[model samples]
Target: MAKLTIVASIKVKSDQVDFVKSQLENLVPITREEAGCVQYDLHQDNENPAHFLFFEIWESRELWQDHTNNDHIKAYQAATEGMVEEFVLHELTHIA
Candidate 1:
């Protein structure tokens, strides 16, 4: 079995950056505690306050899917509804 890595890129409305960041911050600890979560880190772009990224490593794709279905993640989606301008998820298949 191979571990899966995911990078979630998000851009929030300029005015809502701080609020959205706070919401994202709350998910970090909770997500890190989930089963098969090898690493879950949140990062904000140094120059673009509205841009946020999440780097996650999971034991398997199924486990990562489970994490996405968790309650806190749902809450995050609900809370940030229209505040998010763009949300893109990329699954990285590390080569080398």
Candidate 2:
């Protein structure tokens, strides 16, 4: 099966950027430790401090689904629910 990829673009409130960044940083190690996670990285937009991106790669779609159900992920979602201005999630499959 092809690998699964997720691209999440988040726009945070200007006053909440630092706090949001910190929260996202905490998820990095936890995500990396998940069984089927290949990569889970957080990136900030060079020109826009309020914008951030999550680049995730998983062994399969099933694994990605599992990730969303994980306790830590659930907590993260709840914690950031109202802190973000906008959030977009995109799923992709390896092309080559």
Worst 10 residues of 1 by lDDT: 87-96
- C-alpha root-mean-square deviation, candidate 2: 0.9
Instruction: Please give the lDDT score at residue 1 for candidate 2.
Output: 82
Global CA lDDT computed for model 1? 0.94
Consecutive 10-residue window with the lowest summed lDDT within model 2: 73-82
Each candidate's number of clashing pairs is 0, 0
TM-score of each: 0.97, 0.94
Q: Which stretches of candidate 1 lie over 4 Å from their true place?
A: none
The candidate maximizing lDDT is 1
**Highest TM-score among the candidates is held by which one?**
1
Q: lDDT of all the models against the reference? A: 0.94, 0.91
